[model samples]
Structures are given as structure tokens and as C-alpha cells.
Target: MSTVSTHVLDTALGRPAQGVPVRLSWITDDEVVVLGTGSTDDDGRVTELAPDGLEFGTYQLWFGVAAYAITSGQSIFFPEVTVTFQINDERHYHVPLLLSPFAYSTYRGS
Candidate 1:
């Protein structure tokens, strides 16, 4: 089984992106399956989008940014972001995002 998590940071504001809504999905050649969804905490971490004993498959993470940026008083061009990755091993996957209106980055974390 595999586990998945994520953390989001607001680079422009130099702080955690709190209250950002995220949707976790399982993706395949055929279609996408919704795994779970949650909002980031004060620390911008969503550590448990799925239950324990997660299954291995291709997964997609969608983050809502327009509302978040607007509420935070920043104008944003990209409203939503999608990240697709494969989770095949029995280890845990932490997908971290450093984001701003003009740029964003992601990686497979610890």
C-alpha cells in the first residue's frame, strides 16, 4: 500500500497557503476517481487525503487557487492547478508545492 500527502506554501506572501481547498483523485487511462479532498491548515499541510492502507495507482491532485488568492488580496491568473503522478510503491509520497501568481513548483517529498 501507498500513502499520499501534500503541503502548500505561498511564495509571494512568504507564508503558508492556509485554507486552500485541494482535491485528491485517482487517475487512469480511462478516467479519474475521486479519492479525497481537504483544505490546508494554518501550516499549509494536508497530510491525510486518504485513509490508512492506501492502494497503489496513478493519482491526481487539484488545488483551487483563484479564491484563495483573491481572499488573500492577490490577483491570480491560474485558477486551478493539477498535478498527476504515479504511486506504485508501499512508501509514502509527499507532494509539496511552492506557489505564487506568476510561478509554481512541485516535487516528490519525504
Candidate 2:
């Protein structure tokens, strides 16, 4: 079993990207199964996407950025972002997003 979490930062604003919607899903050969959905809190963290343990497989984290861009009064080139990762062990997976209106970055964190 494994666990996953995420954090979002608004690079342009120099603050946490609060209330950004996120979706957690599992991907298989034929279909995608949604595991959970949440939004970033005041700290820009969704620390419990899946309250239960996650099994080994391919997973995708989708972030909704259009609303965030509108709220920030900026035009965004990419309205959404998706990060796909594989789970191969029983460890904590921390995926952090460094985001702006036109660009974003993500990395496997501690």
C-alpha cells in the first residue's frame, strides 16, 4: 500500500494556490477510475487525497487551473494540468506543483 499528497504554489503571486480543484484517478489499459476529488486548502495542500491506502498501479493527478486563473485575473495558456506517476512501493508520494498562468512544474517530493 501507498499514500499520496500534493501541494500547489502560485509562483506569480508568491503564495499558496488555495482552492485549486484536483482529481485523483487510476489508469488501466481500458479505462480510468476516479479515486478521489479535492481542492487545495489555505496552505495549498491536499494532504489526504485518498484516505485509504493506495495500491500499486498507474495514477494520474489532474489540476483544474482555469478557475484559478480567472480568480487571479490572469489569462492562462493551459487551463488544466495532469501528472501521471507509477506506484511501485509502500511509501509516501509527495507531488508538488509550482504554477503560474502560463507555465507549471512538478516534481516527486519527500
Cα shift from native, residue 41, model 2 (Å): 0.3
Q: Which candidate leads the pack in lDDT?
A: 2
List, residue by residue over 1-110, the lDDT tens digit for candidate 1.
Answer: 88888999999999999988999998878998898999999999998899764677888999998768977898877888899998777998999988898888999999
Instruction: Give a tens-digit lDDT track for model 2, residues 1-110.
Output: 89999999999899999888999999999999999999999999999888897999999999998878877787888899999999999999999999987799999999
Among residues 3 or more apart in sequence or in different chains, the pairs in candidate 1 whose N, CA or C atoms overlap within 3 Å are: none
Segments in model 1 whose C-alpha atoms lie over 4 Å from true places: none
Model 2 residue 35 lDDT?
93
Per-candidate count of clashing residue pairs (backbone under 3 Å): 0, 0
Output the lDDT of residue 74, model 1: 89
Clashes of 1: 0
Task: Identify the runs in model 2 with alpha carbons over 4 angstroms from their true place.
Answer: none
